[model samples]
Target: MIATPYLLYLGHSNDEIGIKTSRGLAVFRPDICVGEFRHDDCGLTLGLPRLDFAAARDAGARTLVLGIANAGGRLGNDLVEDALAAMEAGLDIASGLHQRLKDEPRLVAAAARLGRTLHDVRDPRPDIPVGTGRRRAGKRLLTVGTDCSVGKMYTTLCLARALQARGVKADFRATGQTGILIAGDGVPLDAVVADFISGAIEQISPDRTDGGWDLIEGQGSLFHPSFAGVSTGLLHGAQPDALVLCHDPMRRTMRGLPHYQPPRLDDCLEANLRAARLTNPQVRAVGIALNTSAMDAAQATDLCARTADMFGLPCSDPYRMGVDAMVDLLLAMDAPAATETI
Candidate 1:
């Protein structure tokens, strides 16, 4: 009798476990072509379509390994579902080979492997030096989201450019899961979140840069369920001088849909303000950035006005208003000597 090699079916393409599994499978079966199918905000579905059960049967791959993060937690549900779906699709899904990622607190170490080590790579605690005394000449601003993919990066980058254009020395950092890119200095996503709190503070503190540098920090969201990469957590760990909440107007009605929808101005503003208060109880002001992925000028402008009226904070279509104007609005809302210096 001849012995055959085993085949594994893994799911979830965003994090480390999935990456490692895919790489391992590719190494073992160089002939197999791997394909990734991702759904908007829904996560990824990975498969090996070319390799059939017959091949597996011939090769003795009758056993399959299913990868999962948390066995019973919300994150694990999708993995479990994928495994079941593969079985339903007639593949020999393995029963006991349910692999789970080790219960690590954060992804900092994983990120470091990707050359994105955060500041103080050794320490994963949230403790950090807070600037003492009064607020200095530079403006302190924070960018948060209603949920992930609400265009936080584009807005922050645009704001940075805008501040620089107006002669305001501006620096930006992200403190969420994705924020690891800045914290780890280009590390992988997993490792970045572990050390982001302390790394972000060290990166943004005036001591790290010249005077008059406008500092902006990025956050995922307070309510995001998966990964729980909330900006509110960052705010609690490292307090900022001011807060900016980025939101999508159509988040409620069109969520989980294939296409993007422009958010309603009033609804978006209200949701952002509520979420911001969850983090910064005393958020000095609020602002809105229209994600133009699904809207035109007239719709964006009308939504902007509704947001401005609802939140009493300056609003702009980030795609149209130019970054400089955003920075100017942020600067104008600064409260002198308002921060509790570290």
Candidate 2:
């Protein structure tokens, strides 16, 4: 486990979306978050107490979470120096960046010399088996997006919580770095070898006879050029019984790809459903989750209503509004189609 009571390092990131690793933990797992560590130029804040590495360690922080994210997940020279200093100050380090912390010679040497552990959250275990595509006993709901960072993890987490609140057994299966940290354990699908991505998910979320649900957090979009492979692998591996299409209504273009347009909701959902059918022919879409954080309450609600009407599926801003409607639809999958508009 990545020792908790974290000191979240924000570095100098000005983009809120880029610092989602820190924002996600702060919003969902605040009890374990001791404080925020930011450089002067950093433009964002999690509203946690600001603390230096030494102060954070003194405040019962055991690990420094390198929470910033970038296009390439690269570690800058200054960030590496900060990491070394954090280790020197009697704290272990945990990171989910594409750049492996264990691979950096300076960090590796510092870890050995200071007796500090470096937890590379992206590192997959060596023993994952190949996917059998055999039917599992329990139910699963996966969140697919029209683009990356379109609230897949948020929707999955909200659904899991709402299901549990209704006395339905549910587990949130994390697939990305932020989700892994929030769930405390998950297979980093992007980090797994392409051939074994599906198998890795299969290993993490095995069959359950308890009639519970596994709410698997999704990764990139099927429409995204850079990460569709990972998304397809995850969809096949999950063998999900239901799906929730998550989207950001405001995104005019695919994230990080200005020239590419976001997929139409109908097209995106159809593609995901077609891909999912490879493993579970019975897979169905239960709801739509929108990232309406950028809109007013009235606007968000209207958008959700229109979306639900369009798809004949329960739709809501899982964050601004509750996911109970979606949960209701998920639990009663035997009911007739709401509208068959799709």
Q: In terms of lDDT, which candidate is strongest?
A: 2
* Minimal lDDT window, size 10, model 1: 181-190
Q: Once superposed on the true structure, which residue ranges of model 1 sit more than 4 Å away at CA?
A: 1-138, 176-210, 227-229, 253-282, 323-325, 333-342
Candidate 2 per-residue lDDT over residues 140-225, each given as its tens digit: 89999999988999899899989999999999999888888877788888878878988988888887777788999999999999
Local distance difference test values of all predictions, in order = 0.46, 0.89
Q: Report how far off residue 94 is in candidate 2 (Å).
A: 0.9
lDDT of 2 at 165: 94
Q: How many Å off is the CA of 12 in candidate 2? A: 4.4
